[model samples]
Target: MKQIALDIGLTPEPTLAGFLAGRNAEAVQHVRLWAESATRSPVPSYVWGPEGTGKTHLLRAARQALQSQGRVVGWLDTDTPLRTPFDERWDAVLLDDVHRYGPEHQHMAFNWFVNAVSPLHGKPRAVLAAGRLPPADLPVRDDLRTRLGWGHVFELHPLAEGDMRAVLRQSADARGVFLSDEVMGFVLGRFSRDLGSLMQLLDKLDRYALQTQRAITIPLIKSMLENE
Candidate 1:
């Protein structure tokens, strides 16, 4: 059988302003400062946490923030191709999902770490990395693993329920949709609570609302789920 993709609405690009800092406010602030080129140190910034802690979100936000300032940044993750070696002209590098890297990615990441910290002719470039484990506990090569801890390391935590509710409301408002308290309570009670999952649900509801020419309500949500 062929798979049918859900018509989820356009997702708002991840931005520092859109991120709900929750308990990770310091991490967010650090990333903001780093992206602004305010941090003088060449040491990399590392963030680690379980899934749904917004590790990828922070990385992408930093990337956008840096590029907006006319800085060249290279982004790498488990999915991004690693064909070229690290270049000094790039102002920064972002490595996502460091915990899941295989041997090849580990080697490439090690090179990125080394070159980012100690460029030959110019000022050192910043490196930002994220993973499921802290640098000390990462399973990558020992040398790369040690370098991951050379700078700031932050452990992100899941958002609080209040924070989650605020985020849902904020997202709904941004889309010009009214999410009732009833719908919010029902959705939060019924589905996965992770911000990633919740945002996806919001996207689907937004699309369903547009499709059916109706406001998002508990019944509409149920209908969408039932139709699936």
Candidate 2:
């Protein structure tokens, strides 16, 4: 996937809408705190959590919020090249999936991270999102691991059943689709509880409904599920 920089002026209204719709109060609070810290801190912070826990979305939201403040924020996907150096140029850095970077790149990331946090003439703040906490048996340098542990680490908990329903409803509403309670129950009962799977299933259903000109009723959902 291409690394896109978010428009700084964008209000992050869409992200807020999704958070409200999903009733993710904790995430909302975390975003607020991260924005505040990014402005004041010298070192970068890490937001670590399990897979499918909305870490990516929160990171993007933080980027949007920071950019709106006229800060020069850059996003680096650890799976991609870390071409930008941590000099006096950037105000903040957002690194996604930092755990996935290979050995050499991981070292480079670590050095860049230290420089960003260093009390030098031009150091930038940083925010990183990872599937797990750093220094946990991953193939990362020890110094890098220690540096990653320096900042605030917030773990996004898995959504409960009620929260899951809210997330599904929010996702459907965002897509201009109505997913009924019965259909949702059927999906939850039959499919994996992971948010990634649920979102993918919703995408498939949305496309299938559009293509077939059918409402996403329980029967239609069942038929689609059966076919799949």
Q: Top model by lDDT, which number?
A: 1
Candidate 2: tens digits of C-alpha lDDT, residues 1-228: 323423342222336336532444665675666675635565556666667666676777677777778787756676555555555566766767766767766766766676666636754566554545444545577777776777666566667888889888888887778988998898889888877677778877777676567889988887776888
Model 1 poorest ten-residue lDDT run: 1-10
- The alpha-carbon deviation from the true structure for residue 36 of candidate 2, after best TM-score superposition, in angstroms, is 5.5
* TM-scores for all predictions: 0.89, 0.76
C-alpha lDDT of residue 18 in model 1: 83
lDDT by residue for model 1 (1-228), tens: 323434443566678888889999999998888887655468788999988788888898888888788888888888877666887778899999999999999988988878888877788888899999989899999999999998899999999889989989988887779999899999989899977788889989988777787899999998998999
Q: Candidate 1, 185: how far from true, in Å? A: 1.1
Which predicted model would earn the best TM-score? 1
Candidate 2 weakest lDDT stretch, 10 residues: 5-14
